[model samples]
Target: MTFSPTTLGTGIAGYNFLLRTRATQQAALANSPQVARDTEHFREKLKDIQTSDQLMEDRAMLRVALGAFGLEDDLDNKAFIKKILDSDLADSKSLANRLADKRYLAFAKAFNFAGESGPQLPDGKSAEDVTRDLAAIRTADDLLGNTSLLRATLKTFDLEGDIGNTFFLKKVLESDPTDPASFARRLADPRYAELAEAFDLSDKVKDRNTVYGFASVFADAAATLETPEDLLEDETLLTEALRVFGLENDVYRPDFLDSVLRSNLNDSTSFANQLEDKRYAALAGVFDFHEMAQAALAEEPFTSTLQSFVTTLNARSEPVTTSNDFFSDIKLMLETYKFFGLPSRSNQAGYVNRILNSDRSDPAAMIHGVTDGRYLALADAFRIEEPNTDRIYPPEFADQVVTNYLDRQFEISIGESDESMRVALSMERDLGKVIGNAKGNDSRWYGVMASNLLREVFETVFQLPDSFGTLDVDRQLKELKHRSESYFGTSALEDFTDPDRMEDLRRRYLMQSNLQSSATSSSASIVLSLLSRG
Candidate 1:
């Protein structure tokens, strides 16, 4: 039987025994003596154990039981209370007692310096390491405790890490200073102490403004770092440095760079003059064409000259800006270059085809424009729209054309830019002269080529003098035709005696002559007449 500690300690069991005997005797007497005796017996059967003598006599035994169950009530015996708490068997009354006392609950969390075990120390580790470890642990503990100390510690340690990375240090300085103290703490970290020394970080006061201000200083100092990757690693520093130096807004994106290179075909001598590095001495530094020519200029001036001549011829291609202007402008640009004596119509034609192919304009229009006579007409068309025809002229045309192309034919190709075009044209004309020199009265195939040229010239003028209205188309055409047939007899057309063949020959002669006359303004009357007769 379980007993209360108060009952055992005070010996109250004997008083409860007498009360129990009286209730039982009263209940027994009633049942034995008929109905009257039953009432009296029922009153004496049950009794309170609180006043029992038996309970009092068993006091020593009760005490033993109390002690076994950790029920000792002495105030100094905390061990008993602890044992009660550790017991597996639950006693509601004991638990109630513990809840009534708040002091016991508080004591559990309190550190016991005298007897409880503490964290162990590391062996063979330096004092500094040990200190840091303890600090870290404390910091973590503080964090869990919801103290601001953890945030402070984080700021302090971050600063330390940054000190070791100069790039990172610059970034920190340039970064927005949302937390002035945190930024300062980070900069003061021992690892960054050297960087701070170099940049003089201490001069700046602790404020949000100063964080970015200090960052600018670091960025400027860090500009010495080479390579794009190095700059990227510390973007904060680079951005700050770029801002302070006014380079941020000036930086070119991909599109801008492409436009810059494409617009300046010739060397940007003025811009180049500003650059100190020889590697970037010219705009040509980035262009492959210029680089090849530049190399040639150093090693083989002749080769470079030839290449440049070829390039000028190719470049004569009129830009395909609009539909109406496409073909006509191309034709004009071509003849303009050709009249100046550019060699090989092949290169000029090739450039025009390329521009059209790029879909800058309709290819059909471009083809028609290039093939059409009256290149100068196309030139006028472009002049109204773009007005930058001066660039289209080979560098030599700061002066005149026809006389220059014929007189300085070889010199034309030898010189640079427009000179090449003039020389090429001159060479074509001189080739006529050479044919003339070779034929000298023998007047066979040699004289036929020149005669064919005049014939074509005259027929073109006779057909459309209005198209070549700028010159005396009729007069020039007739004179050229008369001179051509004078050399090649009427037998020139004798070979085409068949009626069908003669008709076809006439159409071919007229078409070719008209196309050539439109472009040159000068007619190849002799050439056309020879072909007509044949």
Candidate 2:
């Protein structure tokens, strides 16, 4: 059978013995085969976890993690746990912060997984990595097969937020980028043109020769035209020439286009000049059959001016050398540095550089010689000189969690015999954390009201009626403050951090809880007579 932790007795004398022998009993419980197995299982399973979501997925890891905070019963409330873990505690409206219970807030902060983990360029695929092999995307059909690339293209042009219009994207890809009136050119955002150039979707500017060929062919076709109607007989020449003037769609209306082509450009009343779009006029001007040579030269069919602009974007990778660079990767954060009792010196590159690069394997390393322990912590977390450490949380976090899980489990086991003893023990364990985390008295007061164990103990010690909980939050806060000042000589919860005050509070809780238990037995007409302090 698992070793059940023993409580001495219910009175002040019993409670003191429980306190005095706690260390020894704790050692015995920790060494018990069952407790050791539970702790070992937790330690073994928690090694791979770095995120809160990852922890939730594992029953083993979640058991210990939830148990560490006395929340093991919530193991099945996965969705609620997820919401709490995902919340931004800094935002007052976040689920964790909005809840009256601050236990969820502490749970969320323990495995802080929401938001960016650190300052480094991501170790995995990053937002900038959403690219496709533009070389492989030969046809519009090829682009359709690659949805990731489609999203990447959409993201690059700052259009990923909206549902992409596949038809419009295809048209942009198939339009002649060299022609300013093409689909991409018609769009207000000029980045579309850049996308077209990158994909060369129209295939018009495949090489310098392709551009020259189309321009030469149009010039040749225009010179041989006896009438504009004669040019329509040659579909190839007509389409190429129409695209240059951004009138490729008009190729189907050959007869009308021919008539417009034949119209005199200088006449405002001409069919071509009378249209809303001047593209028809430009088309007629270019194929005027008289100024064909000068028109072809003047239009300069895509002079390759934007060629350099179409060049591939190079992704830059700079080596991490400075402390600024070190902090960019927050996973390497030395948590121990916060306890250094000094101002944040992450900006002190000279001191940090020596710390990061110092050889720690050697007994006489520069890091070990430093009087400030923060430098040693920095070197240990980064191990920059060693270089291949892959730990997610710092090494110490695992041990801290293991000890917390073990201690909480032992404290809970004490409650099996005497439920009141559990609340007393949990108060000693939980009160410091509750007060320490809160910014003010109001916050600390709410913290106590939020926790079940603390609330039960306070409710008994202050002799508050069960209906006291139904009062307005402000009223409850006022009453709690008054009760605290009368009981502990200070409304401030900080005073209870002293060992004397905590011990006194523990004694009051036990005595009050014992009186309540006896009164309940005395009042019951059919008392079971089974009320032993056990």
Candidate 3:
């Protein structure tokens, strides 16, 4: 017979159930007409299988019939219906009796049954009772055997990553679920403390309230202390003090607490004695005590010398130009030295003293005493002319020397790699103006220094794998133009085209090409020598 839409329910679940029943009936009829007849007869015998006892009997009968026919009875509705249809009358009755006695319906409803239908339990057991049974079934073996369930449980505690970890699994399986102390021991372990915290399963996990209460107690006790000595005798305060510093386990150790309390914070020796303890090593290492002490001792003299240097620079009136803040200029110079990882503070002080003590009329004397490797690099970088004992620089030469030194250092530190060459070129152009402006400027020392720096840049570039033409000339020139304009205004471009400056640049380029040729020859000679020796 064809079923109408009205005969089936409107709900999705009810419709699905009826469809499964129909499918099962069709399968049974296909196996044998007798199986269909038996299913109809059984349905007639039970008007409604609504009760727990009735459902239990039905399930057992179904299992027996399906078993006889070698048909599998799964949790699905179709399988359940098919099992009942294939059951033998005699076997079905006997199996139903056993199932009802054992309360098999409750187990089936809890685990096997599908959909949102409420489980029909026996009169004494409620839904909660079935839940309790399910919870109790979670033995260590049961959990281990069910990987999905075990993984889900671990995920609930934010320990999902630890799932399948043999060591962690072993520890978890070893802990007795029934023993509160066993659970506490696992929770107390720092390794599992985070998991315990995620699950809200540990009483020892301190919350804001616990911290506030501890703080309140400490504040009350500390308010009564007239001196640091008062902390030694109070046992309660001492215990809390230990707990405050995460040394709660040592609260009972009076000797440790007494030693902590007796130690004077003001006395360096007492503080050092406390730091000798392995426990305080981590805390002690947080501070660089040696550096702090050295800085404190050096503070006064360093400040005085810096002030004197600033005063000397400010007093200079010759070579009058803009941007004459010596303090800021000298600070920038010092920072540049630091950036290059050269010249310790002692050497810096010596340099500063030399600059301050040298005759303001001739600053070339300041370069005389610098024989150190670090200072030699600075001299080369700045193109500083070495001092001649008989020759004295002009009065205005001192300002140029100091200005050139600071500018070169500042540019090298701040400029990009290619921009360093651009800066040297810009300096050459600018210093040319200074040389040209001076009366009887026969020395042309400033022009010479700038040309020397430019030559050095060319030498470096020639050593590189790429030629100047192959390099990112557009980007380099753009950056050079921007920096020069920013520092020396737009007029810097005009200065670059000066006849004398152009001639100097041409000469410097030739010198660089010659030097590269010489270097290549020297390298070839070394390689030939090594081959000859071989």
Candidate 4:
């Protein structure tokens, strides 16, 4: 039944019961009438101790004294003890120490009937019945003050069968205050240890449900795991710990590696193998591994873990079969990899080819690859060329594609794959800008040979893979003109690409490019134009 706060009468009753049951208390009281009066005085003081509200230390002290008195015989005694326990104490530290020292120790010894009196009852065994139990008490000094019972009943009794008697077990540990090492030994006694361990494990499971949360039990185990090596070394315990590492007890699953893999990639080739292994493919076909990778990359703890995962994907060398979902995942992985500055060169080139070669053709995927910006620098660095051909889309068409792609036209790809439409377009656009901006005396000329080669490759794609002429160049030009006007206000396109304004354009482009070297010109057109304008 539920209990309210303690009353003064209840507190006094509880205190008196403690004195009656404790063997030391009973013996001490019986020493004289003065001792009995002292006990009653202590009870009256406790009534004063009971304030308007409950206190933790007070409750604990009351329970310890009550248990010491062996008042478990009466239901009213139980109520008194319960109220004391249920009381909310103001001080926790005082309570922790008090309960540990006073109540807990006394309650524990009460089970053995130390200092109890009277004859055997009709309903329950009396003080004599406690002889065998008292034999179990690991007492150090009597009230008369003499040492006895070093090993006590703990050395002989099988504690497992007496699991219900945890009170005495706790006492045996607490009774010898000076001997912590011996105390630990008794607490870890194999029979008692087994029951305690089981109870603790069950309680932990009830408290924490997730795999991550359940993993905490192992963390606690890791703290004070010293023992008879056998229990600590048990395979079952290790397996439970390993499961938290994502290893579902099988090498085939990617999570089968250490949960540490989420934070450290250099740990094993096994992690790489599972990510790259094609056999145990993702069964939940719609889910993207990239989502998990992205989240990991975004968090510091998971950074290296995602890096290792990406590194593994890069090494796979084969395309994860493309469904709409797989393709989307591949895109996400590429974007995440690039954002983290971990681009895979061979994989990018290869994955692009695979996308181009895929049965399910999509143009938007190409747009995604170019705008990610990671490979734009690479495209300029490598000067990678398209093969021989002569097709050329107008500058405006290329510019519109660049603008749309840059304005977040598509979500990025995440995997380190060799196939993506966006990557191809990015390479093409970056190459085009390289060519369009090329001047005889321009730094853009630095990569002219590579740009020319790339132009040829673009032409080849146009003629053989797809026709550039089929693209609506004129419409694209109009759209570009309109956008430029909208941005620069009506006159933005006026003489914008005019040869007459080439000198002005060159200066503007040079200034905008943030080139360290100044652009100088010997052209009479610029000089004459400047003079005439002046």
Candidate 5:
């Protein structure tokens, strides 16, 4: 027999009639003690509706009611109602059995079963137990499926961007709900170990922010972290943190140093007091505020003295008009040098003899004889131009000499000499022909001259032997060559006509020269000491 909505409605009407009849019978027995007891029992059942046993009983009653409706052949309610309305059922028992089968099939389908005869839990396990297991399964699915929650969880350990990590996802998915140690095992995986250690997730972590704060501490360490576990397992993090705070080199008390870093960084008094600890006596040299201030104060006179020399040199009259004028300028510079406590009288006499005797037309001969340190210091101080090898001194030669003098003088005053600056100055002088040709034509001359100067500077500067042997000169040269090719192409100087190109070259040259200058210094103290001892 087939059932439709009409037949189901008729069944509902019959069920209502049965309820009314039962109500009438209960009313008739209302005065009886048994009826009152039954009523109280029914009220108790209503109150216990949320209980597992009550819920199970309610489900059973619902199944029975659906079975009696003659619409149990369909799994879906809408489909069943449609069938019921279209069908003509004459036998009530047959309809009830078919409806019961349909209702059973629907329950099986909803629970991922094939039919009424479906897989079930062991004898001791109830539907409630099955439901709890299903809930756990759903939770695991949600954890994997919901990207936001997954990202948030990873973010707590500074691993938010590792969402696509298959191993992490697999481990998370495999975590057992029943075993508390299961999650620990997954987190203990070496891949996630750093994160676990940083976040202190080995134990219960209540606040997400606390995990992030701890993670940040490790990330703030100097060396790159391979894994979160590296934060604790390796000395790299501790060493790097100590180095960053300037406590690495002289720190002798490891325990005390650790305590200080872990303390509040904002408390200057606490940090100052830590420095006073006798254990950190070595750091006293660096931390001595009074000594540092005194040293800084001591340099003021030297700085002022150098400034005065620069001003005097800048204000000196040009004395290269003739041999006699040049000699007069030299005498004046000698007196200035004497005033500044630079050249000895003998050195001055030697310089004068070299200048007077050397061919007046030959700058190279004149400078070649004036190689004494004292003479070099004085010549550099007074901004004296070096005579070019060419007999005739062009205006370009004068400019080159002035530039070289100023550069060397600056180096001397600072008590440092930069090999790169030396190379750059030499290269600038060597490129005199190229610079002379470009002069007075256009502003592009500056750019071309500057780029050529830098090209030679980098080439010569990078080629020089590294005093510290720390720089990878070869790699730097390769990178510089590549950058030069990319920025200026193969013919940088030849394309100097373009104003934009020239400007770019000028900017690049100045930037590189400035950077190189900072790293390079002219103080060959070790060599000088060796020479003095010899």
Candidate 6:
């Protein structure tokens, strides 16, 4: 059932055929014994490995591991790979940072044997799923065994980097938050106390939510401040606390306010007590550096809350899926939109209807045609035309790594057979992602130049010299910009968002590649003939 690339021949026609049927071909490959056995072996063995040495010890997993990041060539270079994996990422002179190809750095980050980013939830796990898992943790062993829950809790407190440091985590969770001299309190970072506050080690578990509401979340943050200066540094906490005490106008007068906050309210002559308005004393009382006053956090961040609401709107979004519930929901949605700063079509039901109905992924789709990046981000977030499953967690992170490995394996396989088709596949896969970023074209262009597969295709299609790659970064950017304008009449990556433009790019590369191959062949023949005559 294997569809060999040899049958497809070479150049533009073959490229077109392959592009049209790539999904099916990859599906077939995924099921084949060679691919299936290797992937299954890697999956089964991956969990046992927590270090680069362990990974390098297993050749089968190592193959898939390296293949995932297009680093398959380094299969024999385990020492070098291990060096990069263990290098101090903070040092610019480290082996990983010194390399021109960033794939090595990416490869190290993906494995994260050195705990570069700490722990995150495994990929594809929903928020609801995490909440359930966290609720189930009633003991120290339960907390340790469910690393996902542990990591999610840490992440909520912005302490995800300590994910691998399980021993330290156990000590923090087991400590009493009420005791200021305890392990959690002893840490200079107030986030640790916040962590200690959220978890009760005596089998009393609480729901951990990273989201903020002005009342309880701010109140919880207020209790954690050890100094008046600590209170001033956080704008969100400082502003909200000021508003609570009717001193919102004094936000700009930091030094004056800082002095006032430091004043002992216990003394009648204190700055806060002397103020005519009683609100100043109240502000000083709550923020006094003496004892901590804590509150619980409200569930859901603003974006997460907004996304959750949009999740409910997808089914009733399109015009054709009408129901009586839709009218009432639409009314609620308008207010929700206004609250979240989303652009809502208040009176324009027709426009809203089309946008809701349209496929955000399609260039011809109504939402995709919107000029505003905000609308695009909103539309993309909603996924109205398809499933909108949550992509968060300690749960999602593991699956994300696995998916990356397999997809990279697929890319590398195609590359081994035909490099042209490999580059074409990368463009088809990554073009939209690069263009969809809110960054300007120069940043996006660097994304192309950074990738060996992508840069080769663009250089070939635009007929840039091989020496163009040798130019300074700025000079190279200028060349890409100049060539892009000469060919496409625009230097913007956003202009290439359409699938048709990508295909056009593919066709150009294929045609030019074939021409180059033919000319090289002709020159080689002349040289051979001269050698024979001589």
- Please report the candidate that would top lDDT against the real structure: 2
Query: Scored by CA lDDT, what does every candidate get?
Result: 0.32, 0.64, 0.39, 0.33, 0.37, 0.62
Per-residue error (Å), model 3, residue 331? 28
lDDT (Cα, tens digit) per residue for candidate 2, span 458-484? 888899999999999899999999998
* lDDT, candidate 1, 280-390, per-residue tens: 222222222343445556884332222332243344433333334444555444433433223355575555434333322455544344432223222322222322221
Which candidate number has the best TM-score? 2
Ranking by TM-score: 2, 6, 3, 4, 5, 1
Model 5, range 1-534, lDDT digits (tens) per residue?
111111111122423333345334334433345433433343334323332233234533222223222222332454443333323233344332245223332222222111222222212233333333322222334455656445644654456667887466545555443344665344544435443432333222222112122223443342333222333345644443334223455335555553443333234555533554322222222122333335466764222222332344334433232334445556445434543234356666555545544553575777555533334333322233343321111112222222232333332222223333333223333344343334442322233223434445445333434341344645544455455566567333445445566545434544555555444433466667789999
lDDT of 5: 0.37
How many steric overlaps are in each model, in order? 70, 3, 1, 39, 18, 16
State residue 239's C-alpha deviation in candidate 3, in Å. 3.4
Error of 2 at 154 (Å): 52
**Segments in model 5 whose C-alpha atoms lie over 4 Å from true places:** 1-456, 459-483, 496-503, 509-534
> 1 or 5: which has the higher TM-score?
5
TM-score of each: 0.14, 0.48, 0.17, 0.16, 0.15, 0.46
**Candidate 6, residues 58-97: lDDT per residue as tens digits?**
9888877777666878999989988987876667898887
Error of 3 at 89 (Å): 63
Give all candidate RMSDs, comma-separated: 57.1, 27.4, 43.4, 42.7, 47.1, 23.7
- Rank all candidate structures by their lDDT, best first, as comma-separated numbers: 2, 6, 3, 5, 4, 1
